[model samples]
Target: MTDTATPLISLTWTDHITGRRGHLVVDRLVRGVASGGLRMREGCTLDEVAGLARGMTMKEALHYTPGARYIPLGGAKGGIDCDPRAPEAYGVLVRYLQAMRPYIAHFWTTGEDLGLTQGLVDKAAAEAGLTSSIQAVYPLLDDEEAARRRLADAFAVEVDGIGLGELAGGCGVAEAVLAALDRARRPYQDTRVALQGLGTMGGATARFLTRAGLRVVAVADAKGTVANADGLDVEALLAARDAFGTVDRAALRADDVELPGDAWLSTDAEVLVPAAISYCIDSVNQERITARWVVEAANMPVRPEAEALLTARGITVLPDVVVNSGTNAWWWWTLFGDIGADADEALGHIRRSMRTLIDLMLARAEADGTTPRAAAHALVADRLPEIAARYGWYR
Candidate 1:
C-alpha cells in the first residue's frame, strides 16, 4: 500500500542461456515464508517486482482474520524479463527458477502471475529441479499431503470449462464492482464495463461480471479491442483465447466492432477494469476515461499521477491490493484448510471476504477523506507493524 521499505532480500539473475534478466524481491516475511507469483514479460524490472512485492505484503495482511489457520505470509515476487510467447521463454523461465532454487526452497512461495500460467509454471519448476514453485511454504502446512491435494483439486475443477484457479480472482473483482455499485445504489443490469486484457484475470472477470448482469461491452487483447454495445459473449471470446490470452479473430461476432487496443480505456461504460500489465494507464490516457469507477485487477496498472487525476475527477479507483487479491488468497485458503476444494465454497468465501474487505476499505476512505489508495495504504501501515511484532518480521 505504502512505499516498499528495505527488502529482506533482493536479487537480479541473468539467464545463462539467453542472458534475459530476472529479478526477485522479498519485501517482507511472516512466519518464515513469503508469498507471491512469478511473471514473464518484456521489460519487467527490479523496481516493478519490488513494488509488486510490497503490494503482496499488503494483500496478505488485508486478508488477516482474527483467528484463522492460514495466517498471512509476508510478500515477495519474481519476475523474468522476456516475452512468454517467445520460443526461448520457457527455457528462460526454467533457468530463472533454477537460479532462485534456494529462495524458492526457503522463503519464497510463488505460482503464476502475468504472462505465465500455473500449468506452465509447474512444468518449468519441475525442469528447474524444484519440488514445486510453492514448496517453500510446505514447512508451514499441518498436513502437507492433504493441503497439496486441496490446492490441486481446486485447480482441476473448472466452471464452464475455465479452471477455478483462473476464476477466483476475477470473482473477487466482480464482487468488488458489485459492492461499489450496490453502495452507490446503482443497478448492475444497467451498468456497462470495458476491460483491458483478455488474459487469465481479465477473461475470468468478464465471465463473472456478465453472469452478475453487468454488460461487458468491450474487451481488449494484444490484437485489439472488441466491442458490442449489448454486452459481449464472454464465453465465446474466452474460448477463442490461446495460451497467451490472445483471442482468435475468427471467433468474433459479425456485429462485434473492432477498435484499437487503447479504445477499451475510453469506451463508454460505467466501469473500467484494467487487468493487464503495469502502468498501462498514465495521466495522459487517464483523461479518456469517463467510467465512474476504475477497478484495478492488475498489479500497479494505474500510475500514481493517473490515479490522482482519476480521483480528482470523482472516479473511485479501487486499489489492486484490494481488488484482484482472491487468486492468491484462494491458494492459501485451500492449502491451510480454511476452505475446501469445492468451487461453490471457494467462490462463496471469496465473495464474503472481498465484500467485507471492500466495505472496510471504503469506510476508512470515507472516514479519512482520502482516496481509496491512500486509505488502503493507511490500513496496511497499521496492520504490518502488528503482524511483524508477532511474527518477528522475517524468519
Candidate 2:
C-alpha cells in the first residue's frame, strides 16, 4: 500500500553548495496548509521522506478534536541528505531551506526532526530569508502576532532545565506508556525501561518516566548502551551530554556498565523505546526484545515485518503516528489558543491528550484483536473523513 499512494505534490532538490539532495512531500493539505518537520541526516532518501509525510497525515488526522480551536492541518515532511556534523552541513541546510522557502511561505510549516535541533532550524530558516519556519500557518490564525508571540514564549519556558518545546514530545511518550501500563494493571515501580537513543526525545522521556517511578534499567546513546541493574542517575547523565546526544563516559557511575550499541535491545526490561533512527529493528534484532511493549518514540523505528513478529510474540507495539503526535499537536494547541505558554499547563495538556488518545487506540485494538498501529490507522480513517467533510480536502 505504501508503494502506491500518490501525494498531492513531491519535490526534490540538489544542494548547490554541497551537492547533497533534499526532498519535500506534501502528502495532503487542509485549508491550504500542511504541517511537519525537517530532518537532516546522511543517507536520507526521497522514499524515506515520502513515508514520513504519509505518517504525518495519519498523525494530523488522529488528533482531530471536534469544536476545538486547534483543528489539525494536513501532513507533510522535508529531509536533507547530508551529515549534520559535517562543516558544510549548515550551508547545505541554508540552501535547502531557501529552495523550500516557497513551501514554507504558503503550505508547509515545519521545525526540527532527526539529526537537527530546533534552534538550528530557526537560525537556518532566518538565514533562508523566512521570518518564521511556521509562517505558512499564519493566515489561519485570528491574531498572527499574538500567536507567534505565544509560540515563542512557549519555546522560552523551561522545566527542570529542559526547554518546554523539547519536552513536549517526550512527555507525550511517557504518558502513552503510563496509560498502556494502567490498562494492563501493571505497577509503575515494577516496569523497567530500556531505550535506544538518549537524544531530545529519549532524554526527556527518561526524565519524565523516572519521575513517574519507573526504573530505567538501561539507555542507549551514539556511544553505546549504559546499563545498571538498578536505575542510573538520569539527571546527571542528562546534564553531561553534548549537542549530539552522546552521553559522556566520564559521567558514568561506578555501577554503570557500558555495553555494545545493540545491547539495549536485550536489556532486562518490561518496556523498550526505540527513539533513534528508522529501520533499526528488523526481523532478526526483534528476537532480542523481551519487553512486553515497544513504544516507538521515533518515526518508523520498527520495520513492518519486525512489527508482525513482535505481535506474534505477544508483545504490544505502540505505533509512532499516535505515540509521537504530541509535539506537533502541542504546537497547534498553543498557536490556536487551546493552551498558553506556561510549562505546567502545556505538560498537563499533553499528558491528558496523550493518555486519552492512547486509551482509545488500545481499546479499539482490543475490540478488533488488532495491533495498536492498525487500530490507529482505523481511527485516522474515521477522523479524516469527518475533518474533510468539515473543511474540504483542499482549500
Candidate 3:
C-alpha cells in the first residue's frame, strides 16, 4: 500500500529580507511531475500545506482512468505564512518563487489559491525567468496557438482572448449535491440548504443551487449569517456582497433575519455546504448541524471525528475530493481534453465529470456499506499499485 503518512518531499525556506517563511510539500511524484496551488494566508503552516498536498494526491488518484494513458501528475502544495495585507507580501512572494524556481520548473507547477492572485503569480514567474509549465500539459494544442499562449503567459496577457481562470468549486459542488439528492430519491425543489462561507466557492455554490431550484435559506460569511425561511434572493445577495463575499448588513430586506454566529449550524435546512475552511465542522459543532447532507466544498472542511459523529447520526457527508473537484476537473480537461475557447463548454465538461465521479463513489459506498470517504480511499488504495507499476515508481 502507498504510505500516506509521509510526503515525498517537504521543504521550508525563509525570505531573509522580510523574515517571511514559505513551504512546499510534494506528496508524491509521478514521472517527476507534481502540481498544486500556492496559498498565502495569515497563520499558514507547513502541516496545512502537507495536508492539502495529500488531498490533491487523493483527488488525482480517485479521478484517474487507465485509458487516459499518461503519467498522472502527483500532488504538491505551496504556502506562504504571511499576512497578505502587509506591504511586504508581494516581495515575499517573489523571493519565495525564486527559492522554489528549480523545483517549479523541473518537478512542480503551482497555480493561484486563497490569497494569491493570477497577476502576482505571473509576475513571480516572470521575475524568476520561467515559462508557463502548464503549457507542457496541453500537448494537443496547435503549434501556432501554443506559441501564442506561451507569449501571452510570458507577457501576463490574456490567452486565447480569455481572462484568468476562475474557481469552479461551486459548480462542481452543486452538481455533486444534486447527484447526492438524486441518489437518495429527494427532490431538489423541495430541499433547503444552509451555506457557510460565502466567498468564491460558497457564493457560486449558493447561486447554482438556487438556480437549480433549491431554496438557500441561510448564507454565512466571515461577517455574519443571514437567513430567510422563504429563501433569500441570491441575485440580490450577490449584488450586495463585496469582492470578498461578505454581505452588507444594511442590504438585508425587512423580512430577512440575522442569525447569531454559528446559527447556520442550527438552521432548518436539508443540505449544508461548508465552503470556507478546514475543520468548520468539529466535535463541538457537529452535534448541532441540522443538515442531513453535508457537502464539503472546501478541502478537509470536516474533521475526521466530526465526520464519524455525523455519519453515526445518519448524516451523509460528501467529501471535498468528490464535491469540490471542479477546479481539478477543469485543469485536467484543459490539459488533456478538447476544451475550446468557450467558457460554458469548459464548465459543462467539469459538471459532467463531477456528476459521473460522484455517482461512481456513491454506488461504491452503497455497495460496500461504508462512507463515501472510505469508498474513495479504498478506490485509491486499489489503484495505487497499478499507478506505481505503470509509472515504474515500483515493481
Candidate 4:
C-alpha cells in the first residue's frame, strides 16, 4: 500500500531570529546530491512535504537533475511552516538556515520555493556563509534594466525571474502540452485551453500560453469558472482579476456556468490545466473529465484512483512532477551556469528539456503498452540504478 517511490529524509531548523521552527523534507535523495526549493507556507504539513518530495522524484527521473542520472541522483523538497508575509520572516529564515547548516554540507542543496523569494534565499545563504563555488556570487539580480541587456545577449529570449510571479508549475504544464501537441503533430497556433487555477503560477502560465497563440477558452478560480468559447480575453481577465486570481463573478457574465467548486474540469477544451492545489481530481469527478489531454499544472492534482481511471480510458495525462519540473531545475542549473548564458536562453533550454522529455515518455509508453507515468518511472528506474551502481550505492 505504501508508495516505495517516495524518498524520505528530514532536515529540521530552529530560528532564533524570528523564534520559529522550520523543517526541510528531502523527499528523496537522487544520486545522494538532490536539491529543491524552500517553500514557506502557513499550513504546510508533513504529508504535503512527502507528496512534494515524491513529485521531485518524478521530476529528477524524467528531467535530468543537475547530477548525472546514473550517479544515483534523486529528488527532494523542503518546506518552512511559517508565514512568509509576517514582518519578522527574514530573521526567522536566517535562523532556520543556521540551524540547518549541519545537513547542508552533505549532497542536499536548497533554493527558493513557493511563497519564498530570491532575496530571502540570498539572505539565508549569506548569513549561513554557505557559498557555492559554482556561482560563487549568487546575486539576487532584481535590477530589471541591467538584466535585460545581459539576458538578451546571453539567450535569445527575454529573461526575467524575480520580477515575474513565478508560475513554475504552470510553465511546466505549458511546455508539456506543447510537447504532447508536437508529438501528435497538433499545431499550437490556435489551440483552446481551460485554466482551472488563477493563482500566481496559473496566471503566469496562462499569459505565456496565450502569448504563444493558445486561445484560453475558460478560466476559473476558487470562486468559479468563466467561459467564452470564442476564446476568453486573457489580458482583460488579468486586468479584472484580484490578487487571489479570482475574477468578480458579478462583473463578467458570458454564458458561464457556475457549477460546484470543482466544475472547472467539465468545461470543454483541448487541454485542462489544474494548477490550484493537490487532489483536484479524484475518483468521483474522474468521469466528468472531458479534456483530450489533462496536464497537471499543480502537484498531484489527479489522485491515484483518478489517474488509474483516466489512464484506463485512454486519456493522455502528464504527471505533475514532469509537467511542473522547471523552477527546481532552474534553481540548481543556476548554480552551475552550465545551461544557458542568460535567463531567456535558460528558459528556452528548460522548455526544450520539458518538451523532449514528454515526447520521449509518451513514445516509450506507446511502444511499451504503458502510461506516461509508468514509462517515466521505468526510465528513472533504469537510469538511477545504473548511476547507483557507478557510485557504489548497491555494489
Q: Each candidate's root-mean-square deviation in Å?
A: 1.1, 1.3, 3.6, 5.7
Give the poorly placed runs of model 4, Cα more than 4 Å off: 1-8, 11-22, 28-32, 65-73, 81-98, 105-107, 119-171, 237-261, 341-344, 392-395
Pairs that collide in candidate 4 are 7-27, 30-72, 30-73, 30-74, 31-72, 31-73, 31-74, 70-387, 71-387, 167-201
Off by over 4 Å in 3: 1-4, 69-71, 133-164
Error of 2 at 225 (Å): 0.8
Candidate 2's TM-score: 0.98
Candidate 2 lDDT, 51-156, residue by residue in tens: 9999999999988998889989989999999989999999999999999998899999999999999999999999999988999999999999899899999999
The lDDT of each candidate is: 0.92, 0.93, 0.78, 0.66
Cα lDDT tens digits for candidate 4, 65-112 = 445212224556677778777778777777767666655656556665
> Poorest 10 consecutive residues of model 2 by lDDT?
1-10
Worst lDDT window (10 residues) for model 4?
Answer: 132-141
TM-score of each: 0.98, 0.98, 0.89, 0.76
Better model by lDDT: candidate 1 vs candidate 4: 1
Alpha carbon lDDT at 324, candidate 4:
77
* Alpha carbon lDDT at 287, candidate 2: 99
Tell me the RMSD of model 3 versus the true structure: 3.6
